[model samples]
Target: MSFTVAIVGRPNVGKSTLFNRLVGKKLALVDDTPGVTRDRRPGDAKLVDLRFRIIDTAGLEEAGPDTLEGRMRAQTEAAIDEADLSLFVVDAKTGLTPLDKTLGEMLRRRGKPVVLVANKSEARGSDSGFYDAYTLGLGEPVPISAEHGQGMIDLRDAIVEALGPEKAFDEDEDDEAETDVDVSAGSFAGEGDSDEDFEPAYDDTKPLRVAIVGRPNAGKSTLINRFLGEDRLLTGPEAGITRDSISVEWDWRGRTIKMFDTAGMRRKARVQEKLEKLSVADALRAIRFAETVVIVFDATIPFEKQDLQIVDLVLREGRAAVLAFNKWDLVEDPQAFLTDLREKTERLLPQARGIRAVPISGQTGYGLDKLMQNIIDTDMVWNKRISTARLNRWLESSQIQHPPPAVSGRRIRLKYMTQVKARPPAFMISCTRSDALPESYVRYLINGLRADFQMPGVPIRIHFKSAENPYEHKRKKR
Candidate 1:
């Protein structure tokens, strides 16, 4: 097994910077603001020959149990408890605050192994603070600049010393632990690539990437905690409590899933702050990379403008989506509320016709099984492929049922159709005057394909192309 280490410290001590440095990616959002990170974000870290799982935790703080800060502190404590080792970061330039000493005492009480990190040691006056870190009684301080890439060798040595040989990684093993699969790569099959290249043969051995996105306080994180059966993420009554698009690996019915909990996306006009913008961007990125997206909606106020906008964005990105009506326990009339929600969804989201909307309560774990089943079902539909001959047959009957409208006083004839790809199920249609074919006709064909092939909810793309002229090609040469 690989080693696991958690970075812990007071706010703005460069713990996240250190995490980004160790992981060699800007996976976590960093800024000068204190308490920017609230949840525990994990990443795979490799330091030359040594590799381990590293978790970046929220800064330790003293707050009431019910407050947001208190919950963030609780998350940090949990990470410390679960990790094999803890890297206690202290700002060498600013010296140590009273909170830092209190945190040091707390770590000491935990009885877990810890290495004191004196960050910003590259600064001219940081030597005094580096010397002062020894007073925390966590042993010698490893002074390094996480931003400037300074003293990483010393940091690696300190980690090895803290973990000891038994816990340290073996130098001979060439293979590293498998990280999350980027299922979003090559989403579109390019030219010279066959249709088989985009086929989605799900390898059950790999984790399915699912991203949960919704407005703030919509219980995106709560639903995940329910699935985990633990309070792994920080939650409170406050809006916009989650800032990062945090991802966690989970198992459902023996199937592995890497679920991402994204920040609540408000309307674009309200997103003026730089931090919130970054959080929203991260959430959007998650949507693009996910194999399936769950768009959670608040039962109390369902189908807000922003909610519809989010759904549209998911469909446009060509990701399979399942609508989750979270907080179902709050609704008084379950049947009536669900009926209204379904109607609204059908009206607002024509792009995703026949979409599945599961009523679930993140707080009480209601209807979670149904939601999981729908996710699995939607994924299957997203990967559905129709045979070329069957596609052409369907195209013939569909055109016969509703003939294409006359464009510029001439009939537009659709000659043939075939599926070019599966993940999102894109198809190409050869037709006369393809450009003249109206969008209404395209919608008609798309709706027909969805109903005929049992591919509901997943986005279906149909590209129209004029049929090649064999006689024109021969005569042009003559």
Candidate 2:
């Protein structure tokens, strides 16, 4: 396992900025607002010859255990406990505050190796704050500008020294071996490149990207924490406690999965706050980037208009989805509720008919295995591809069973069909007078395809392309 490093500091100390710099990606949200990060997030980071698991944690604060700030501090402490080292960041421009001293004392009590990081040291007058950080007794502070990528070499040397010589040597050896594996895995260049060459690298070894999204106060964070078997994410009775979409790596049944716990999304009219708007946008981005999305719903209030809208959005985005009903333990009548929910799922969301709906309790861990199995099943179906011959055969039988409607005394002829892509399977069909095809006729073909292919609960796209005539181009040339 890679060595772990946790970036811990008080609010607005540029910890997230340094995390982004090390990970070489903008995975964490950075803002001027204090206490923006409520959960600790992990990322694979590389610094020169060093490699480790970098954790960006919520700012440390003192509050009652039941309060929100207290919960945030709990998450930060959890990260520090799991990490091999702590990067105690302090804002050089602002100088050391009382809270910084308290945090320093707390880290010293924990007896963990910590590298004092003096952030925002780019200004000329920030040297005084850098000198002040020495009083914390954590060793000489490494003055670096996290945003501007200055003084990284000194930080790298400090980390290597803290990790000790033996560990650093082993890591270098691992990196050398990993470099060979990456080169072999990425060697796809050839003279004639095809779709096979451009296909995304998806295998059992790679983590399955799953995004959990739902309405506010729907227990999204609770469900994720249950899956993780820890209080890895902050959870509370308050609505919208989760403001940023945070991703966590998990191992489920020996399969790697990257689970994303997103902010509870509300309707546009209800989302008036700018922070909420940013949170919703981040959630949408997670959905777009995810391979599968689990739309959680409160069992008592399932199938609301907003819930249906979110499902439709997922379908439009061409993502595999499974409907998860949380808080099932609270239900008084499970039999009747399940029956009604299945009926409504089929009736109301006919666009994605036969979608899998699993009743689970995020708080009690009821039916979680079934939910995960169904999600895996849905992902498999979403990635399924039908052969061209099989597609044409199905098309022939479907057309013979129920031919296209006649338009202007001429029937629309669908001559050929082929699948264009998978991952929410899309197809293209060559047809005569494509524009004359009615929406009902298109729906008929879609339903036929779904039934024949056994593709349930996954979105399918069909595009009609007009058949080209050879004589038309000749006449145009003349």
Candidate 3:
């Protein structure tokens, strides 16, 4: 059975730092900025033999009854109530304060096991606060530096003592539930799986797998909803409502397309929860696996750093990428928007060849058909494969059009090229000296291949390999 624990304290007392430490990852954002964390995040944690679930909550503040802060306090109290034990974290360097006293009394009245964590206690003069924490009446304080990895052993022992030996565990039902939940989650931790509604296998053919990605509240899910003619994903004025990446399959004009509705990605500076961390991982996985990726950005606020990160991931993973400016209906000027998008792409990510940017409106469905057509065209380009004859033929024609540059007064021989794989085509080229090849020249070849083959908006890779003449090698062997 999974036991629960909560790390409760005021803001910036290293509660999130300790949460990230126990989770064994930088899943929670640890900024010096106060109130950066607005949600209660939970993750599976382990310290020594103590395996359980740990929740990191928003800092508890003194609020009047039934206000926002009071509701937040209720959430903290409820999470504490739900846990098997609580870790009350405090800044040992600053010593005891009135907030500490108020929370101490609150935890005391709750009657749950509490372990006082004297955070930021690694340096000199920290002993003064250590002495002061004793008066809080939460038992002995474990002096520790969460960022510096101090006092973890004592923390582990405290956890085991509070949770262990309380009751006998039944492993069978627990394992069953965990297995079910894990399967539903797939690569992610918290999301439930789709119902396998679209098989993509009816006619011995599959449609293009296209995924929609962007920063949070950028109309990613909105685009998919318009294309499907319904709001399959819950839509609202609130941001961050769609926490799970949802997928739905449909036919778009003789093309079988699987569209993934992903949660809006937020910057790491903005993400502070265990759930948001899992959501980001899930979205990244979808981008990697999908054949074509259509990144949606809000027309008003496009090309933020987080959006750039999404675009970079798609390109790095070699997926065909199409940029969509969603909520075009709200844009006051369409021509200016497209111009700015082109300028942004050119300035920020010029390495991409055959990429496309389109303006779309998920709310009014104005440019929905054009977006679908672009996706189909892009997916077609991504899946293009060429035979060796066609590839070498193109190579010869390309050389005739503009031969490769000479190096050190010697003509560089570009012997051959052939497609190796194509879910976004990757090719192999045989050359005399690949070390002399500039990335710009390689990009030239890729662009020629894309233009001549009528492939666009899909990522392509060109690899140079040095190989000896096969006929001479065969003759020598004989």
Candidate 4:
């Protein structure tokens, strides 16, 4: 069995850099900024002959007991404990600090084997600096350049030694734990892709899987009641009601749509009650499963941090996002209120630039039609398809405007770009130097695609394959 190795370090110390390097892909979001990664992410690790499952954790920090950051710390610590060997990483250039010492002591106390990693050690800034790392009491430190792929052979030998020679690893283990979400990508390329074949055969052909989600007492049940013209879910003035996600099917303009009525989620602090937590989890599951999420924020009090977190989670999951400002009847200035909502959505979530926001009073039935129309429109955007010819044309413009800069004098050639999947669209790029591609340039292409194709709010994914066009190999030239 392939043992697990976890890369742990303080923020921006290049733990994710090592992770992406080992994985031979930029699966982890590497940024100059710290605290960009709020969650512990996992991926495959490969170093020459060595292979294992690797986890990238949030930059460790000691927070007060039971706080959110503290909880995150606990989660990372748990991962460290679960690992067979821990790659305790630190910024080699910055040298060891008190936090590094503290982190080392804490890790050693766990009684697991740890390999000290002094990252960013590509250049010999100070030859004597390597001597200081041994003082942490983890024995010899493996100086590595996670960014430059230096000292990897030494690192791999260390791992095989740590894991021992006798352990037979099954290569098929990762295939069993596969995470690629199997979604259909129907005939389309470049700009837009459709999920044509993989979708289930619904009874009446449900076009949109709409989910209504919001904070407690945001009138989600009431709004759903308005749609059904009958009491569907139990409604109450209490903070957390509607324990389960309830699906309601309805026809709008001869189009079939299934709306999932989810429980009102409260602040994580107030969610200690077992029942409320379960309800929140259920709602989240529905959000992942649904085609479009209608964020139901109360017009009386809009855009809570928890609400924003939910929206962020949806975006991260690559699901389509549509905001439904419920209880609009309560707002004092209707037109001014909408203007603020638009500004807030646009400014706060700029990556989702130009997404649609539908205003409605779930109780008054004031704007349900518009909300439904927005759902259909957003779904169309989610299932968008772009042809190969148009995609390359767009790619050419991207290269000309803000071309990829050379890394180590290697001018990266972005050979081709094409959309292979949808719901939300996924693009695969054939590039010579995928490793050197800057995050800024990647974001540029994403933003440009969204703006040019009118797929602003939909989740757009880009995958880089080093080899010549993978799809081209399968085609038989007549």
Candidate 5:
């Protein structure tokens, strides 16, 4: 039976570093900055033969219950309560401080099994600090260098001993309840599957990966928390409260979804801080990997340049997008405001034509159902595919109606076209003088595909190749 472990300690104590080590991935952002991790992130971690769930939480700090830091501490406490064990990490290079001692006392009162981890033991002058960790009375400190990958075997032994054999080696406990959608090429491959027309079956069992992104303090976290029916993420009036891409698995109307709450992205010029840059990079990564993206906007001030830029970025990445005008409760004329938003979307984001814009209020939970429905619908359209026969018929009709412009007194002949892939559907077209095809013609074809196929608001890609000549080989070598 696998168990859950929570990594907790003061800021800059290498809690996140040890999390990355145990998870065997840099899933949690690690930096010299303290309190970089504000939300508790869970990962399926394996150490030696021991398989378990590990949670990386924000740095423990003494703050009032109303402040952001207090909310972060509450999250950490929740994680500790939920975990079967807690890894109380301490800085072996700096020794235990008042804050660490205070946190140790707090953990001791909870009576949860904790293994003291003295990180940075590989560094010089760490011996004194490592020895000092014994004073906390949390049992022997596992001295290891989380950064240099030293003493992992000892840490594994400690975990095994703490959990005991029954829980540590129980393989029949079943995996985590959450399901992850495989993003590998083979999992979503469509091209060359068959010569006949075939629509690839989409597995509904796997969780749908949806990313919620927007500018700072645009109510992204609030919207997610509302969906979860709990304060799963830290939210406040303060801007930039979230600095990491946090993923949560949830079930919506019997459909599984793995929702990602990303850090707020700012303009490139305003992203001068190193930590913010890291956060932005994390957000962009979420966008690239996600199957669908929701661009949240504050309804009071919608369609800002940065908002449009974010939408463009999502389109450029070829991910399915839905526009969410948040804080709609504050809008006086909701219908008129929504109409205006849709008009702006059409004018500003013509690339994602007919995009669904739902007015929502993250605070009051208004219009969340419609927003989610739009997201589901948009994802379906993004994964749509058209048969070769149907595409050819449409192409033939399109050509007859509006023929390709002649180049250099010669006509551009459109030959054949077929969908090579989906997931932001892409098509390959065979034509005469492919290099001479105008951009307008390509846009025309793309628009035709969208309109004729009813694939609205999803990015479509089209490529052209020269039609092979059967008479060239018969002409003989020169």
Candidate 6:
């Protein structure tokens, strides 16, 4: 029984700060720049005993439909529609402006429950703004400092009251029950169980961690907002507005997914600013931790050198990847563009030869289903493991077809092979004079293993081990 609360306000009013506080994590990019948030980002938040979904939205602005601010406004409106309540934040230091008044009237017209918040109340001069909030006609405003954790008790009481006392009690009871069950399960496990037989209880229903990464302004945030059906992240004409990796949990077609909206990655040489370097490091961290990465590209200028580099990094990191061509609606000839793109992908990214490339319009919500499906499929491949017997059979067949080249007039004798691990599929091969194996022969075996095992677009690792000779012990004694 999760309810949603949308935090709406003009730019730089501490909406993201409050969101991070409620969620107990810094999951949104908080900056002093006005209108930094463009998408509506959602997170599971708890205020004291009250639990609900919280959304951080773009700032409200007065602009026409054709303008970027107008589009941001539309996204905020959509969030308000989806939310059960709206936390209308105002700058207590600056008092109520015309924009706040306008937003108050807009929320009033919607006739939904709104909790008017006077943020930055910790400052000495905030009393005036706090008093001014009473004039909004949406009931008394709760004055609190979102940055310093002030006035949270009042805010929590307001939320509990708005949601009704009965619902609050029910949530408490559910939490207690869940805690009791967890304790009971822990006590049930015995210490005598063998490591192989003692399977740790884990929920297979946990959310899949997916990271969206690409060059700056590649529509990564837009794609996530579309999936959520709200303006959940800050998007605008400005590039690099998102400075942190923001993660939001979502359910898609009954599958739980934890989506990471990361800052756009730029080449190291061009990243001169300290902030930009930190942002790139954060994005790299997200990519390394992610189970699957969707590398986004602007369709108008798809597959720049940087984009290819990003894809190569994903492969090198051994993470599953899917290529996404965004803003497909603007493409004039879709079929031709896709054909050319596919050819280029195969030629440039041979490591991930059969990687799925989806053409999508994040704004229009086209091809999203295919993109998600591809992610699931790629994850499956990434976790694939082959049996040892099957691997040895494949190895034998491969050696018969193209035998390892002779080294210094002596034939290199290949022995058996076995799969050492999964999750990118690592293998080990024992052979006589393993150092004599040519790089070309190693590649031949790798290609053969990939083809035989149907492992496309996932990195495979092979390690060569020298088989110990039985006569070596006698020679050592001599």
TM-score of 4: 0.56
Question: lDDT scores for all predictions?
Answer: 0.89, 0.87, 0.74, 0.76, 0.89, 0.82
Q: What tens-digit string does per-residue lDDT give for candidate 2 at 19-101?
A: 99998877778888887788998878888887788889999998999999999999999999999999999999999999999
User: What TM-score number comes out for model 3?
Assistant: 0.55
Q: Model 1 over residues 231-328: C-alpha lDDT tens digits? A: 98888788998998899888887888889999999999999999999999999988988989999999999999999999999999999999999999
The TM-score ranking, best first, is: 5, 1, 2, 6, 4, 3
Q: Return the lDDT, model 1, position 354.
A: 96
Of the two candidates 4 and 6, the one with more favorable TM-score, higher being better, is 6
lDDT of 4 at 304: 85
- Estimated TM-score per prediction? 0.94, 0.91, 0.55, 0.56, 0.96, 0.76
- Of 1 and 2, the candidate ranking higher by TM-score: 1
Best by TM-score: 5
Query: Per-residue lDDT for 279 in model 3?
Result: 73
Q: For each candidate, how many residue pairs have backbone atoms clashing (under 3 Å)? A: 0, 0, 1, 6, 1, 12
CA displacement after TM-score superposition, residue 264 of candidate 1 (Å): 0.3
How high is the lDDT of residue 130 in model 2? 95
